[model samples]
Target: MALTPPAWRHTLTEVPRGAAGVLRLAGKWRAMATGPRGRGEPVMVLPGLFNSDRSNVALRRHLTRMGYRVEGWGLGRNLGQRAIGQDGERLFARIDAMAERYGAPISLVGISLGGLMARIAAHRMPGHVAQVVTISSPFAGPPDATRVWRAYQALSGARIDDPEVRALVGEAGRPLSVPTTAIWSASDGLVGGAICRGEDCAAVEVRSSHVWVQFNPDVLRAVAVALAT
Candidate 1:
């Protein structure tokens, strides 16, 4: 079973209130030091909901340097909806093409809604995906745990109670057949940490903001390690 709000929120909410700025600066410094070295199989980095390919450029660059062929979803922007299956199908097709081009299984590194999409793709096409990594993704529940999330859902025409959303979340509860890792922060101001847990998946806890997860050193390290495996 997943943790309750009181149990998880206390840990996740404390950092954003106090040391967020410091962490952000540290994250940037780490990115500069890590530089680009590049190694593993090809990787697809997907941005969060409402985000664009540019949003994940730094992370993708780092992964490229780490010896991995990194690519971003060419989708224009993320608009939160349960019909994400359409986008997932397109992304899967892209992954298939990349696999053919690279001649190796692809690892998916996704944030927020993109993570859910990656999970769906991996579940449906295990032979094509080698591993999956997610940051601040709500795998086990809706994203609208807070009032701000509720507001965003309403503004974006995303129905939190939509049947499709419920089904997606439900699918997340089952054990993933592919190797999976989830990187979460104690400072995510968006989705509750309770929804980040996985039964058989390796979960790494870090200190970073929800918005800047892709830039955090700890989160990046966790993703790199997961992909390396």
Candidate 2:
């Protein structure tokens, strides 16, 4: 049995909380810059499945004000392999270009599936990525554990059980050469929050619904805290 997807109660609460997140983002966005400010560090924020860089504008915008040099992937919508390349060569290219442009390792802040990819990218190109911060990304559990499995298959054009994909997912759960922060919520409705915790990462709980964990004002503070330290 899939030990995830949360309970019916949590799943049911997603829509309402997710709706509130939008309002909170617009009105309570100041918290995003409350933590330790950045010192011109290169930070890249990756969008979730089916999302584009546009989805992260609020978060990235504040990060810039906090003093970090922030940028979106600029690769357009995230269609899994269609965007990152079958072997993730495209992701590697992005990392390489950013590292070159920044003249230093870049920090990766990813939401949901994007977080999984960020972890994988850090592993593939060790030291190129300074650190990784995952928001509600289930890298530490079976991909099927999430309610988004069918959506993943439809969008990524790959099965969760496919040998190659399985290997990559497995790799993402392992310890990284750089620091990692796994920010998840027990109140999440779509995926198992437990699965989001990495083996050797700093785990933070924000008690949010899965749909908009990335947009929550408190989540913004969490991200700022993660990057600052």
Predicted candidate 2 versus true structure: per-residue lDDT over 1-229, tens digit per residue: 4566788898888989987987888887664556599899999898999999999888898888888999998778787656544746777898899999989999999999889889988988887899999999989889878888889899889888888778878888898989999999898888888899967899999878888777788788888889999
Provide the global lDDT of candidate 1 against the true structure: 0.71
At residue 50, candidate 1 shows an lDDT of 78
lDDT of 1 by residue, 1-229 (tens): 5443323554455456425644654657545545434475789988887788898787787677677889987766766553254355666688889888899888888887778777877887888888889888878665555323565475457566777766766665567788899887655666666677687678888866676677666676667667776
lDDT of 1 at 53: 88
Report the error of model 2 at residue 152, Å: 0.6
lDDT, each prediction: 0.71, 0.86
Distance from true location, Cα of 127 in model 1, Å:
1.2
Give the TM-score of each candidate.
0.82, 0.95
